[model samples]
Target chain A: MLRLPPFQYHRPSQVEEAVELLDRYPGDAMPVAGGTDLIPNMKHRLFTPGHLVALKGISHLHGIRVQGEELTIGACASLTSVAQSREVRTHFPALAEAAGQVAGPQLRNAGTLGGNLCLDTRCTYYNQTEFWRRALGYCLKKDGTVCHVTRVGRKCVAAHSADTPPVLMTLGAQVELVGPSGSRVLPVREFFVADGVWNSRREPDEIVTRVRVPLQPKAFHGSEASGEVSTRVRTGYAKLRQRGAIDFPLLTVAVAVALAPDGTVTWVRGVVTGLGARPRELTGWEEIAVGEPLTPEVVEALAERAGQQCRPLENMIQDPGWRGAMVPVYVRRALGKAVKQGGGGSL
Target chain B: MAPTHRIVRLTVNGDTRTAGVPVHYTLLETLRYAMGLTGSKQGCDKGDCGACTVLLNGEPRLSCITPVWEAEGLDVVTVEGLAGPDGALHPLQDEFDLHGAAQCGFCTPGILCSAAGLLARNPRPTREEIREALSGNLCRCTGYTKIYEAVEAAAARLGSGDAERERGERKEGVS
Candidate 1:
C-alpha cells in the first residue's frame, strides 16, 4: 500500500491565507486542491513536502460566473463541474472535451482545474515509485542531475502531461493568480515556461484564483464598412493515446483557425502538448495556411511542417520516435476537424 | 514511524458517529477497520481501482486516497447503505441480483455506488453514458456485459415512466 509520508495538513479558508501559508513554508510546503495528482505523487515519494496547504476549504474558489463578455471559472472548480457546465460547453467546447478526456470520471469528479493546470510534468523515468527510481539510479527530474532520456542534456526533459493547457491556449484564456503582493492576470501562454524544472511562471506564494475566457461573439456578422470585423473562429483537439480510456495522451494537438469571408485563413494557432517539456504554440503556420483553402493536401503539408518543428526526446510513455511520427497525423486530423467545424472548407 | 491517533467524526450509512482513527489512515481504512463497514473492498489501495469507491456528499470519489479528516461533516454512502431503513435492498441491488451481475462480487460494491451516483444525477442515462461513467470503476469478472445490463435495468426501474408503472403493478399484485 502506498502511503504519504507524515506531514502537517492545513486547510485555509481563503486565497490570502493559503498564499500566506505557502509563503511561510517556502520550499517545504505545497498547496493541494483535489489531491488527485498530488496525493499519488506524494505516496510515490516524488514530492516530500513538510506541509500540505489545502485549497478545498476556500469556498470562493468554486463556481462559474459569466459577466458581459467574459467567463470566469474558479481554479478550484472540479473537472466534472467544468466539463458539464453549460457556459463552458457553449463557449469553450474544446476545454470541455479536454476535461472530459482527463483521467476518468472518478478522477474528474475529484480533480480540480487548478490541479490539472498545475499538474507536475511527467516522464516515464520520473513517475516511478521511489523504489523503482532508486533501482534505476534517480533521473534528472528528482535526485540526479543527468536526464536519463537525453544523456547529453543538463536539465530534466520531462514532458508536460496536462490535457487542459493546449485547449485553453487555443481559446485565448487568461489565468488570475493571487499572492501576498496582490493579484495579477496573465495570458495562459505566458504562465508556462519550456523548462520542466520550473514549468509555471507563478511564484511559490501565489495561488491560482480563477481562469478568465473572453466570451465568443453572439453572431458571425462579417466586418462592416466602418471596419469592425468579428473573427470567425473554429477550433478542435485530437489526442493520441494507447487506449480510448483512462490514459494520458501520448501526444495531443489543439488548432484554432480564423477564416476570412473569402474562405482564406486569416489567423491560425496550433498548440501541441504531451511531447516536450511544455506546451508549444507552433509559429509560422499562418504563413503556410494563408491565401489557400483548407484542403487535405494543404493540411498534410502543414502537419508535416509542424511535425518537423517538434523535437520529442525519449521521456514519454510511448516510443519517442512513434510519438514524433504521430505528430503530423494528429495535427492533420485536428486541422481538418477545425476547418470543417469553422465552415471554411468547400463541401 | 508510529500512527498518530485522531478522533474522526463521519456520517456513515445515514448515521453520525465518532471513532478514533490513525492520522495516516485513509477514509477507506477508517470505514473498513474502525467502523467495521467492510463492504467497501480495498483493492489496489491506490485510487486506480474503484473497489474502495463511495459517495461523499452525493458524489462518487475514490475513498482510498481520501483522508479520514476529509470525510468529517460529510455524508458518506457506501454499499452497506444501499438498503432501506428496514434493511430492504435497493432496486439497483435487486436488479444486480436478477441480472446475475455479481460473479466474484469483489467489484460489485464499487460498481453499485458508482451507478447510484449516476442514476442520482441522470435518472435515465444512455448505454454509452453508463459505460463512460463507470469506465473508472473496473470489473475484472463477468466481462462487464451483465453489469451494464444490470445498470440499464436499474435505471429503467428508477426512471419515471414505463418501468415505474411496471413496478407499481408488481407492488399491487404482491399486496
Candidate 2:
C-alpha cells in the first residue's frame, strides 16, 4: 500500500477563508479540490504539504449558471456534472466531450473542472514510485539536477496532459481566481506558462473560483448547391491516447472557426497539446484560413502547415516520431469536425 | 509534531458509524482496516483500478483516492450493501451467481457496485450502456461475456419484479 504522508485537513465553507488559510501557510499549504491527481502524486512522494485546504465545502463554488451571454462554471463542479450539463452539452459540446473523455467513470465523478485545468504536467521520467525514481538518482523536475528527457538542458519538458485547456482556449474562456491579493480574471489562453517545472501562472495562495466562457452560436451552414450562407461559430476537439477510456492523451487537437455570411472564413484558431509544457495555439493558421472557405483542400493546407511547425519531444512515453506524424492527421480531423457542426452534436 | 487525526462519522450500508481516522488515510483504508468492511477491495491504491469503487451520495466514486474525511456525513454504499437486509441477493448478484459471472472474484465487488449505480439511474440499459458503465472495472476472466449477460438478465428480472416475488415466496415458505 502506498500511504499518503500525514497532513492537516481544513474544510473552509467560504472561498475567502480558504484563501486566508493557504496564505497563512505560504509554501507549506496547498489547496486540494478533487484530490484525484494530487493524491496519487502525494503517494509517489512528489509533494508533502503540511496543510491541505479543502475547497469542496465552499457553497459558492459548486454550480453551473448562465450570466447574460456567458456561461459560468464553478471551480468545484465535478467533471461528470460538467459533462452531463445540458447547457454545456448544448452550447459547448467540445468542452463536454473532452471532460467526459477524461480518465474513466469513477474519476470523472470525483475530479473537477478546475482540477483538470490545473492538472500537473506529466513526464515518463517522473510519476514513478519513490523507490523507482530513487534508483535513477532523480531528475530535474524533482530532487536531482539533470533532465533525462534532453540529457543536457536544465529546463524540464514535461508534457501538458490535460484535455480541456486546449478546448477552453479555442472557446476564448476566462479563468477566475481568488487569492490574498483579491480576485482577478485572465483569459484561459494566458493561464499557462512554458516552463514545465510549474507550468501555470497561478500564485501559491490562489484559488480558482470558476471559468467563464462566452456562449457560441448554435450552428454554422454553407450550401454549395443552393449557394446559401449563414454566419455561425463551430468548435471541435479530438484526442489521441493509448485507450478509448482511462488513459491520458498522447495528442489533443481543438479548433474553432467563425464564418462570414458569404461562406468565407472570417477567423480560425487551433491549439494542440501533449507535446510541450504549455498548450500552443498554432501560428500562421489565420494566414491560410482567413480568406478561403474551409473546403477540404484548404483544411488540408492548414493541417500540413501545422505538421511542419510542431516538433514533438521525448516527454511522453510514445515515440516522438509517431506523435509528430499524427499532428496533421488529428488537426485535419478536428477541423473537419468543426466544419460539420452546423447543426449540433449529431453532426 | 504529532499527526492529526479526526473522529469521522458517516453512514455505511444504512448504519451510522464513527471512528478516529488519520487525516491522510483514504476512505478505502478506513472502510477495510478500521471498520472491517472488507467487501470493497483495494486493487490499485490510485484511481486507475476500479477495485476500490463505492457509491458516495449514490454516485460511483474511487474510494482509494477519496480522503476519509470527505465521506463524512455522506451515505456510503459498498458491495456489502447491495443485498437486502435479510441477505436476499440483489438481482445483479443473483444473476452473477446463476450465470457464473465471477471468475477469480477479485473485481466482482467493484463491478457490482458500478452495476448497481447504473441500474439505479437507468433501469433498462443497453449493452453499450452496460459496457460504458463498467469500463472502469477491469475483468480479466470470462472475457466480459458472462458479466454482460448476467447484468442484462438482472435488469430484465428487476424490470419484471421477479426478484421481489421470489423474496415474498421464500418468506412465506419460512413462515
Candidate 3:
C-alpha cells in the first residue's frame, strides 16, 4: 500500500483565513482543495509538505456566478458542478464539455476547477513511487539531475497535460489569485511558462481565488462597422487521448472564429496544448480565414500552419511522429466542426 | 510517539458517527478503519477508480480523495446501508443479483451507490446517461453490459414504487 507522508492539516473556514494560513507557513505549507492531484502526487513522494491548509471549509470559495456579460467561478467549485451547471452549459459549453470529460465522473465530483487549472505537469518517469524512482536514479522533476525524456536536455521536459487551461485560453479567461499581501489577476494564456521545470508563474504564497470568464461578445450588437465584419462567433474544442474512458489528453485543439454575414470568416484564433510545456496560439490563422469563406482549402492550409508550431518530443507513450501528425488532423476536424455549426458552435 | 488525530463528526446513513482521523486520512480510510464500514473498496487510492464511491448528501463522490473533515454533517450513504430495516435488499441489489452483475464483487458496492444516486436524481436515465454516470466506476469482471441492464431494471422497480406512493397520496387528498 502506497501511503502519504505524515503532515499537519489545518482547516480554515474562509478564503481570507486560508490565505492567512499560507502567510503563516509560507514555504512550509500548501493549500489543498480536492486533493485528487495532490494526494496521488504525495503518495509518489513528489510533494511532501509539512503542513496542508485544507480549503474545503471556505464556503465563499465555492459556486458559479454569472452576472450580465461576465462569469465568475470560485476556485473551490468542483468540476462536476461546473460541468452540470445549466448556465455554463448554455453560454460556455466548451468549458462544460472540457470539465465533464476530465478524467472520470468520480474524480470530477471531487476535483476542483482551481486544482484542475493548476494541475501539476505529468510525465511517465516522474509519476512513480519513490522506490521505482530510486531504481531509475530519478529525473529532473524529482530527486535526479538528468531529464530522462531527453538526456541531453538541461531541465525537466515533463508535459503540461491539463484539459481546462487550453479551453480557458480559447475563451480568453483570467485567473484571480490572492495572497497575504494582496490580490492580482493574470490572463489565463500568460499564466503558463514554456519551461518544463517552472510550468506556471503562480507565486508560492498565492491562493487562486476565482477564475473570471468574460462574456462572449455578441457579434451583431457591437459597433456597426465591426459588427458588419463579424456577423457571428463560434468555438470548438477537440481532444486526443489514448483512452475514451478517462486519461490525460495526448493533444488538444481549441479554436474560436468570427464570421461575416455571408459566412466569410472575418477572424480566427486557435491554440494547441498537450504538445509541449506551454500552449501555443497558432499564428497566421487570422490571415488565412479573414476575407475568405471557411473553404476546405483554407481550413487545410490553416491546420498545416498550426501543426508547424508543435514540438512533440518522445516524452509520452505514443510515437512523437504520430502524435505530431495527428496535430493537423485534429485541428482540421475541430475547425471543420466549428464551421459546420454555422456559427452556432460553443462560444 | 505519533501525535493524536482530530475528531471529525459525520452523519453516515442517517446516523451520527464520529472518528479520530489524521488530517491526511481520507474519508475512505476513516470509514473502513475507524467506523468499521468496509463495503467501499479502495481499489485505486487515487480518484481514478470508483471503488471507493459513496453518496455525500445524495450525490456520488470519490471518498478516497475526500478528507474525513470535509464530509462532516453530510448524509453519507454506503453500500452497507442499502438494506432496509428488516435487512431486505434494495431493489437495485435484487436487480444486480438477477442479472449476474458481479463476478468478483469488489466493484459492486461502489456501482450500487453510484446507480442509486443516479436514480435519485434522474429516475429514467437513458442508456447513454447510464453509461456516462457509471463511466467512473471501472469493473473489469463483467465487461459492464450486465451492470447496465441491472441498473435499468432497478430504475423501473424504483419508478413504479414512486408512482404508487404518489397515487396513495392523491387518493388521501381526494378523500
Candidate 4:
C-alpha cells in the first residue's frame, strides 16, 4: 500500500491558467498530463511536488488534427488515441506502433503522447521503493550524490526508456510548449539534453501544448528535383523487452528511409534509445545509405556501424553485452521492415 | 493554492455518487476507500498491473494512475457494475464459472472489465484480439487458457443477442 504524498491539485481549463499555476509554485509544482509515469515515480518518492497542475482539463490540448503538410497532436491526447488515429497510423506508422506498444492497453489508454515524450529516464537502481533505495544509499538521479551505474562518472547515465521519442526523432518532430513567458517550439531531437535527471529542456513552469510532425521529412542532402521525381518514403520501429507486454524496452530502434523512383536512397536516418540519457541518432548512416539503393548489404553495413557507435550500460537489469549485441540485429530488422513497407526491398 | 480536497461527482455502475477526497487520491483509492467500490482491486498501485482497470466513457483505463478528479462527470463501470440490474451474472461471469477461469479470483474483476470493454466495441473478437485486449490484465494462476476460453464462450453467447437485435431492426425497417 504505497501512498502518494499529499499535494494540492489544480485543474486548469486553459493553458494560460495551467502555466500560471505551475509558475506560482516554481520548483514545488509539476504539470501532470496522464500521470502514468509521474504517479509511480511519486509513489516511489522520486518526486514529491507540493502542487500538481492538472492538464487534462485544458480543452485545447486534446485533439489530433492535420494542419496542411504537418500533423499536430495535442499534448493531452491519450496514447491509445494516438496509436489508433487513422492519420497517425497512415503517415507515421512507427510512432503509432511505439505508442501502441507502450506498457499495455490500459496504460496506453491513460498515458498521453506528451507524457510519453516527457517520460522520466529509467534505471535499475533508480526505479525502486524508498526502502530499497535507502538501503543502497539512493543514486545520482534522485537524492544521492553518487551514481550506482557508473560508480565513477560525474554525469548520471540513466536510460531513456520511452518508446516514442526515438521514433519521433527519426520523424523530425517538433514539440510545442507554453510557459509563463510565452509559447515556443523546439525540434524533438533538440528537446532532450544529455543529462538523465530531468532530461528534457522543458522548464518547470512550461506545459507542453502539442507536437507537430512534418508530413514529409525534409531532404537530408537537400537535392530534390522538381515535380515528377516520384519519391517514396518509409519508416519502421523495433523494440526489445523482456515480455511481449507491459515491459519497458531494453533496446528500441527506429528508421526512416526515402528513395527515388530508381531505388536510390535520397534521405535516411535511424535513432536508438534505451542506451543512455538521450536518444542517439545514428551517425554515418547517410554515408552508407544515401545516393545508393538500400540493398540488404547496404542495410547490414548501416546496422554494423550503429552497433559500433552504441554501447549499452548497466542502467537496466539486462546484460549490457547482450543488449549491445542486439543493437545491430534490431537495426537491421527495422531496416528490413521499412524496406518491406516501402515495397522496395533489394534483398 | 488549490484546495487539497474536494467533492468529486461521478457516475459509477449506473448510480451518481459524490465523495470528498484528497486531491492526490487516485481513482482507484477514491473508488475503494471513499466510494466503497472495492470490486476494482489495487495491484501494483502503479500502471504496470491492470488490477484497477475500469471503463471510463466506455473505454478501459487504468484507474490506478488516473487522478480521481479526472473521473468527474464521466461514466465509470467497475466489476461490480458487470452484473445486470436484476442481479443476473453477466455471460462472461457465468462462462468464467463454467470454465475454470478463476483460481484465486484476484485478477478476475479487472479482466472482466477489460473483456467487457472489448465486447462493447467488438461483439465478436478473434482470439488474437482477446489476447491483445487482456494483455494488460495478468492472471498468474489460470495461465490464460481457461480465461481465453471463458471470454470466447461469452462472446458467442452475447453475439446471438446482437444478431437478434439486428434482425429486429431489419424487420422494423421493412415494416
Q: What is the TM-score of chain B alone in each candidate?
A: 0.89, 0.92, 0.89, 0.90
Evaluate model 4: give its TM-score. Answer: 0.95
**Rank by lDDT, descending?**
4, 2, 1, 3
Ranking by DockQ: 2, 4, 3, 1
Give one digit per residue, the lDDT tens place, for model 2 in B71-101: 9888999999999998989989978877789
Worst 10 residues of 1 chain A by lDDT: A219-228
Candidate 3 chain A least-lDDT 10 residues: A217-226
A235 Cα displacement, candidate 1 (Å): 1.6
Clashing pairs in 1: none
Native interface contact recovery, all models: 0.48, 0.72, 0.59, 0.75
Best by TM-score: 4
TM-scores of chain A, one for each prediction: 0.93, 0.94, 0.93, 0.96
Proportion of true contacts reproduced by candidate 1 = 0.48
Segments of candidate 3 deviating more than 4 angstroms: A217-230, A342-347, B162-175
Identify the superior model by TM-score, candidate 2 or candidate 4.
4
lDDT of 3 by residue, A204-227 (tens): 778898998866544222232134
Give the runs in model 2 whose Cα sits over 4 Å from its true position.
A216-230, A343-347, B1-3, B165-175
Worst ten-residue run, lDDT, model 2 chain B?
B166-175
Q: Candidate 1, residues A47-141: lDDT per residue as tens digits?
A: 88878888988999999889877888999999998889998877666778788888878789889998888988889898888999999898888
Model 2, residue A98: what's the lDDT? Answer: 88
Q: Which one wins by lDDT: 1 or 2? A: 2
Question: In model 1, which regions exceed 4 Å deviation?
Answer: A216-228, A340-347, B1-3, B160-175
